[model samples]
Target: MNQVNTVVLLHTVLHCHFTSADSIENYLFEHYSASMKPRRNQNELVEIDIAMTIQTVLKVDERFQYISFYGWFEVQWRDEFLMWNETEYQGIKKISVPYQQMWVPDISMYYSEEHIHDLGVHPFVSVTSQGHVTWFPGAKYTVQCYLKVKKFPFDRQKCSIVVAAWQTTDRMQKLVPRARSVNEVKGIAENGEWEFQNFTYEENYDAEFDLTKIVYTLEFQRRYRYFLLCTIMPIVILSVLNSLTFLIPVESGERITYCLTLFLTFTVFLTLFDQTMPRNSIDVPYITVFVSFHLFLCVISTMVSILTISSKRGQECDSRDTQIVPLESQGEDLHLGEVNADGKRSGSSGKNYLRRTLKSILKEVFICKIDTVMLVMNFFFLGSSAFVLVICYIS
Candidate 1:
């Protein structure tokens, strides 16, 4: 048997020791001017690709008509000025430089009404041997968008983050597909009030300005659990409670008090709810209507209670007036009539009293029947309203 020995040697190269920082700086300074773009000519279309990942939804201000969000923005383009031969620099493939030294394109959010906040957490500049320049800007954008809030807490909203060149139009610049994977892009710190549904990308053209715009539309559905537990459920309960006033006996005088207290409570809740929303009169919110309906029901119940009290007082006054005449006749008979006349007058007085008593009892029975009918009607209204509201919320 023969034994064989095999050996392999691996050689590693170190280029950082030989390549001086001054030489790289000098090359960059000579090749790139402060005002020059990476393109060869003014008409040359410099293509840039944008890839962004949503980090958090800071705030969606309906009152101010703006949405604040944090995202990671990566802009990539080929820089002919930053390229160097790899073989000439002892296999040195890349180098880092200050961001301020390069002439970055002025890509901005077209719909942004305010300045974007950039969190300088990472290095702002990158250079590669193949002449690729990348800028990773921490994008904290506050974009202005119109929000339709007719449904409010139960509303789904579509918002956009539009990106375009500030001074350069589509004739001079173009946007291409992103090189990085976009599947990982998502809302990191989600807002408790809203749930991220999905998002889409679209390219829009402005005919008047001849500009190409890139848009990222974010669709969000509001999380109604908070409002349901805090505002909506309480208002519904108050509505039912107010409607219960009709079940109370109007003569108790407490019916009006109960309804009035409930109305005031509903008003307090309404005020609080209003404070959380924008005060636009263009479209009234469903929540506002619901609260107002409860208040209206309370008012109607109070009026009914007042009417009942008035009716009772009027009946008492009539009874008193009827008794006065009978008493007077009885007194006059005792003074001026013989036994036969007195006996006849007493009988006649008794018959008239019985007739009036029967009439008063009948009137009271009729009034109670009306009260019952009203109570039934009010309860039905309350039930239907609650059912409709629940359907709207769930759907």
Candidate 2:
């Protein structure tokens, strides 16, 4: 009966166009109702093939864990009134119809994190007078996704854009991939921290939920040059400077002040860096661990300086005691009775030998010279830092 009506309408419309273009327009408007459903048979599923052309990637927020991009979504489906026979209409196979007068799919983005209150920019759709509907709509969206930042400055992350029908079910509609598979997208603005590596597309059919989902995966690698200059390089320079404090003379009384100042600088950097990272991420960034290790090295260098200074002061006190005792022995009269009063001469000789031996052992086992200890510390600090950097960048 629907086919017979279509044939009858085609015959009438062919003759009506001779009157005026409005006659054909009026006939189409009367034939199709916007309130009418697009599906010829309401119970059968209407399959929609979707494709996207990404204009630009606006921004990716690590703190908020979201991605913003500008793109247009192309949805192709079939409609009934839009179709016409070219032989009957003097080769007019397709025609423009006011979208307000035709029914469009109620497809919406699923898993959208930010709410866009506007109805979005709708454009005119091209349709064959037999009912093939092709609609393209532009959109700017911020979608929430999980980010893996354990390696941070040298990490590769895979983020995805998941889209599905908000209310449409498998029984009512089906989603399909475009013929070209995944289309190319442009990253218009260069990201300071991340660079686009590659992308892939997937179609997921969920049996339990009876829904079809589309996923587009974007993989990005962190751009290390910026972070190397702003964060990692500074940390390394500070670590090397802390080791330099070992070169300061203990007698100058400046070593303690210098180490404390460097330590305070590390504290400031750590605090600032924390604000830029995701606070609730399960995996701690390798860069954070790297900076923390350098900070620990600074603390150790400071403590060592304090200990060395204290040891030098103790040695001076012992030397003064020895000098005063010799002067007293000379003034007391070099007699056996004086010797007995002063304790045994044998005991004094033993004490002098032990003190010399202790001094020799300390000089060998613990670095007595500031420059020597500092040279060793510098080598160790730089070596360890380089090793960690290699591992982070390569893997």
Please tell me which predicted candidate would have the highest TM-score against the true structure.
1
The lDDT for every candidate, in the order shown, is 0.71, 0.71
- Count clashing pairs, candidate 1: 0
lDDT of 1 by residue, 197-231 (tens): 77667788887777777788888888989887987
Candidate 1 — which pairs collide?
none
What is the per-residue lDDT of model 2 for residues 227-299, given as tens digits with 9 covering 90 to 100?
8798878887887787677778778999889988888998888787687677774967777776777678778
Cα displacement (angstroms), candidate 1, residue 151, comes to: 3.2
Question: Candidate 1 lDDT (Cα, whole model)?
Answer: 0.71
Query: Superposing all C-alpha atoms, what RMSD in Å does each candidate have to the true structure?
Result: 7.1, 8.5
- The weakest ten consecutive residues by lDDT in model 1 span 4-13
lDDT, residue 168, model 2: 63
